[model samples]
Target chain A: MKTNGIELEKEILDQLPAIVLAVDKNFNTLYANNAALTFMGSTPENVIGKHCYNMVRNPQCKTPECCIAQAMADGKVHSIRSEADGGTGNRFLESTAVPLKDEKGEIVGGLEFVLDITQKVLDEKKLNEQGRTIRDMSTPTIKLWDGILVLPVVGVIDTNRAQHMMDSMLNKILSSNSRAIIMDIQGVAAVDTAVANHLIKITKATKLMGCECLISGISPGVAKTLTQLGINLGSIKTKATLSDALEEAFSMINLRVITTEAKQ
Target chain B: MEADSFRLLNGVKAMMDSGDEYSVSGSVTNRCYIACINGELSSAQMGQLYDEIVRMAEKRELRGVIMDLNGLAVLDSAAFCVLRKISGALALMGLKSAWMGIKPAIASSLVDFGADVDDLCICQNIEDGVRLMSFQK
Candidate 1:
């Protein structure tokens, strides 16, 4: 156990898993643990008494935005993310610098801790990219048959997301020049009156744009809510399932999905 | 004696007819507890709002409550359940409530979720909702 003072115990510093470097007020590396030597590929004799930038070789060092410089100025801990050259490849480091104070409660120097965070950073970036991909794939417009564009909504329909769906559906309808659009909500977990009303608005807007909008996938529970609320969605065409909606779409365009083979 | 009697406690009996259009944070006026939906209310947040409404109702001892959803932008199924519970609790207190200015989309969603909205009175706007409570009494 070491006393609470600016003087750091060499035993404690050497045992730590991360690279620990003690710096004087002049920003000189007063002491560097064994891990720091292995990390920088330098020995104690060559590393100590050297400027922090010289030993670490970081472009950001000694600058106003440097973590060590910030901690020294504010007398608090500051952290920065930087890349370091590893034996195999480039590694990410989370460097934290804290103010070191003497027993008299006077700021003496800075204590820095550098942790390897290469794997963590890579994992986070992958997760973010995957989330973006999922969002992009969530809204898919399918042309099941000619003149019919089906947009199957499978997630929560909030105002912003609903707006996104509207924009995409309109674009697909315009491009396909489809006379009808079928919105299937079979994958949606729940429907509130707000969502029902949102669907109606989209349908009305589609009609205004000279396209017929039909909603499908009304579960039994959803039907009960609509009837009890005394809300009449009769003006908007609806079907029990996507197949039924597709059949209706076919009728609107004067076509049908014929199952019979051509006779000789 | 009565909850609305607090207005008379201040010794001002001659009241002007502002037509029940003023807003009070958490109080009852003209036998109605009116609050505008101004915050983002998830199901959890609705519980906090519900507790406050119940407290105000018990204190003012009002007979009617009106929730104004004019500025509301976000809500979930939890909000409807909380409203249902609040309605049930208020019913036991011999007080009824109404929802005003509900966006058509939200109403459609509530209806789609199989919520028994017949128990709650609804109004197209705040002025119409305030008038509803007055007519009921």
Candidate 2:
């Protein structure tokens, strides 16, 4: 009955989808299930007595920082995610190592559990790249004409995005040597008295940098809120549309665009 | 160090005389008092809060008052108006008032709601507040 039970346990281990194996205290391969053997590219007969680390296909096997070695040293379970040369190709995997104990409850070896996490790692990296792309695309500083920079505002302006806009605007102004900047707020949903004040501060700062800042597209609702809040934004120039602001920007720089459609 | 601290999470309890009484943090005859507000303070609580600060300021040679809003989460327009009112009262009492730990959201909203921060001296934290209020400015 005990013999049959041992065979049953062995059969269950062999059928497990995860690559599982056990190594003795000396790091010798004591047991390598079918999946482990497949990972090693060798039969149990050829792998069982070999050094556990050397038998594994992972390049980190020779290093003392291996999860199994750490588990054996501490006589506890340890896990680490690493890229390794697997049975197929290089793959990222979470290698979990649990200390194997003798009958007396002393750790004599360790059982290693490996689960491929290549796709998960790749997906996380892709997500981070997408986030960077979104942030970059969201804030676009445009130079409409020489000495004129236009920042078309849209969507909600969180504190982080507001700070980012400030930084980007200052840098763009310095780099372009522009004399005027038209901040179009047509697409923005709402504005508070504080935002208007912050906008005034930005224009004041731009003025210090020798540039005129024009705030265009002041919606009636925002205008009403500002007045009700008792915030005075009368000091800053304003316009209803981007084109009107551009025309004002042109007049400030002593340049006028006389558009006459050529007869074709 | 008298080590007296009071917390009123709800507004109704603050109105009834027994709950809001507390001592200042420093010397036995300390002139400056610290009120560390925790949790949500609704608009209804502002009247009680103002009365408490006035009561605390009465006849104690009050040099300064430190208001710490580190734990406050939500702030409405009424609350902001009450804050402005309380600051004005403190100024009238010849007390130097310092506000500490104004969360980013509250700071933004205060500005958005046309609440002027210039009414009170704003500090970064309790330590900064203590230092600022300690000096005779």
Candidate 3:
């Protein structure tokens, strides 16, 4: 009955997809389950009694920081992420090392369980790239008319986003030689001191480039907050509506809009 | 000790050399002078150019002067200050001065460094500069 129990355990371990391996304190392979044998592309005869580092190469295999070595020394489990080579190809793997002990409770070797995590790593990389694309798309400078441009600001304004906004505005002004730009803040969440300062800095920078910057879409709540904070936007043109701001911009550039009657 | 210090200062003066990193040349048209400037210039070079412009203005019956900077790529703080001074000096002499073709990057950089450019009359091109001068006259 005991022999049957041990065989059943071995069979269960062999069926597992995770690689199960055992190495002695000297770093020589002692045993490997079927999954490990297949993953390493080695037969039992060639794998047994061989240096595990030479058979399965990893970034930390030859270093003192090896998880297996750490587990053997501390008599505890240790985990690490490694870029490793397998029967298939290079793979990202998560390996956990558990200390193995003898009857005397003396640490003798380490048993390791390694899981393939290539797909997870690839997914995380893709998500990060998508995040960058979204960040760039969030802030856009659009040309509204000849010699006129408009930037519609939305959401929270952080330092990085503010710098990007300034860069985009400056580059667009240069490329188009725009004489005036209207900044609409109707979609902004709230106007705090820092946000107001960022807007002012952007205004001053545009002015330095000989382009006039007008602030529009100032809600009553934002105006009250600006006054309460005592933040002075000196000499900057502000309008209650985008249309009024556009009218001011037109005047600055010596332009005007006139209505004509439709012909019958 | 004082005599030795004086001799050392004199020797240092003798070793000093001067050079201009930029060139300035233009023409006088219809009582309006256009000074085409190119390349980066040191403070001394800018001062020399300012003096040359002022002398030329004194020599001719000019109503306006356009400092064409389309070819100038770099302007440090000192050079920029001198440029402003030149504009002010020309205004004092009753000649309308307009800065032409100020590149976008340089203009932004000047503001970033906290240089005062509030009163500068900036023009998009030579024709706009001429129109600005003519209008002022």
C-alpha DockQ of every model: 0.01, 0.02, 0.28
Using TM-score as the measure, name the better of candidate 1 and candidate 2. 1
lDDT of 1 by residue, A31-134 (tens): 89989998788998998898878878787876887888788888999999998777879899999999889999888889999999999999999999997677
Interface RMSD of 3: 2.2
Candidate 1 structure lDDT:
0.75
- Proportion of native contacts found in each model? 0.00, 0.00, 0.29
Q: What is the Cα-based lDDT of residue A21 in candidate 1?
A: 90
Tell me the number of clashing residue pairs for each predicted model.
12, 2, 0
Deviating ranges (above 4 Å) for candidate 3: A1-121, A262-264, B1-21, B25-37, B60-74, B102-104
What's the true lDDT of residue B83 in model 2?
Answer: 69
Number of the top candidate by TM-score? 3
What local distance difference test score does each model get?
0.75, 0.74, 0.84
**Residue A71 displacement in candidate 3 (angstroms):** 15
- Candidate order, lDDT descending: 3, 1, 2
Residue range A234-257, candidate 3, lDDT tens digits: 667899889999999889789999
- Kindly report the docking quality category of candidate 1: incorrect
Among residues 3 or more apart in sequence or in different chains, the pairs in candidate 2 whose N, CA or C atoms overlap within 3 Å are A194-B111, A194-B112
TM-score of 2: 0.47
